[model samples]
Target: MAIKYKVLPRKNPRDIAAPEKFYAAAIADGDVDLDRLAELISYQCTVTATDCYAVLHSLEHNIIGELEQGRIVKLGRLGNFQVGISSEGKDTATEVTTTNIVKSRILFRPGKRLRSMLNGLTFKKAG
Candidate 1:
């Protein structure tokens, strides 16, 4: 017995680049406000504009706080964010964890789907 296979059409990033161009033009022309732009981007990820902004704001604050503490912060599967230290001396930096010079780092554990996506085994190309 013989089996037949068909190639499925995929939308490459390049294929969708025009939409990005249009979005940029719209924003540059002031056709859409910041809230609308946020909404458009959020829509791509199936999330609400408020939720998207909240996530972005949270990440910004968390990163800033981590850097202020003089410690490396790692968000599992996402990647590590480190703040550079001056060569002057470590003593000048405030420790993230009190009572000890060594600061305790913060780690964000990735959710199940994110973890699986990072592992790169769950996805298969269509044929």
Candidate 2:
């Protein structure tokens, strides 16, 4: 199946006076929830749906725990996830601390296998 996209017109974000431009944005057909994911895994393996759900639930908890502790989590072929921060600048190096941090974000670096999947992906315009 091809990835679907829609042509959308958007104003220049940097300058409002600038002319609007049309860009191709991805259009998601649907989303698979956690339960559906577990069911799929169960179908592919000998594990029961309930057992698969338990494993997935545990994995979600652990991933969050590792991230909150300032650790980079590597999920095999899926990729690596790490905590990233945006902070206000401080005049002195010593003046900067956790309080200056504006927000923390999760960064993902796709593994080789997952990144390579993009190479063969095809795109189609949304209906």
Candidate 3:
């Protein structure tokens, strides 16, 4: 099955001329929630669906716990996830404090296997 994309017109942010460019943005085919994911895993493994759900739920809890401690969580063959922050800049290094932090976000970097799959993906225009 091929991945699908939609062509979108985006304004060039760097150009004052405001030239419009078309970009191919992948369209989500569908969503697989936790229950569905567990069922799929169970079909391919000896573990039961209930066990798969339990393990996946445990993983979610641990990932958040480690990230709260400012640690990067690596999911081998899938990706690495880490916390990213946006903060107000201070003129003096000593003036910087936790209060300066504006927001926190999760950043994911795809591992080699995941990235390699992208190379084989075929795209079709979305309806």
Best by lDDT: 2
Q: Over the stretch 3-95, how does candidate 2's per-residue lDDT look in tens digits?
A: 999999999889999999999999998999779999999999999989999999999999999999999999998999999999999899999
Task: Flag regions of model 1 displaced more than 4 Å.
Answer: 1-41, 88-127
**Each candidate: how many clashes?**
0, 0, 0
Q: What lDDT score is found at residue 9 in candidate 1?
A: 42
Model 2 off-target regions past 4 Å?
Answer: none
TM-score of each model, paired residue for residue: 0.35, 0.91, 0.88
Cα lDDT for residue 97, candidate 3: 97
Worst 10 residues of 1 by lDDT: 21-30
Winner by TM-score:
2
Q: What TM-score, to 2 decimals, does candidate 1 have?
A: 0.35
Candidate 3 lDDT tens digits, 24-111: 9999998998889999999999999999999999999999999999999999989999999999999999999999999999999999
Candidate 3 error regions (>4 Å) = none
Model 2 TM-score relative to the real fold: 0.91
Q: If both were scored by lDDT, which would come out higher, candidate 2 or candidate 3? A: 2
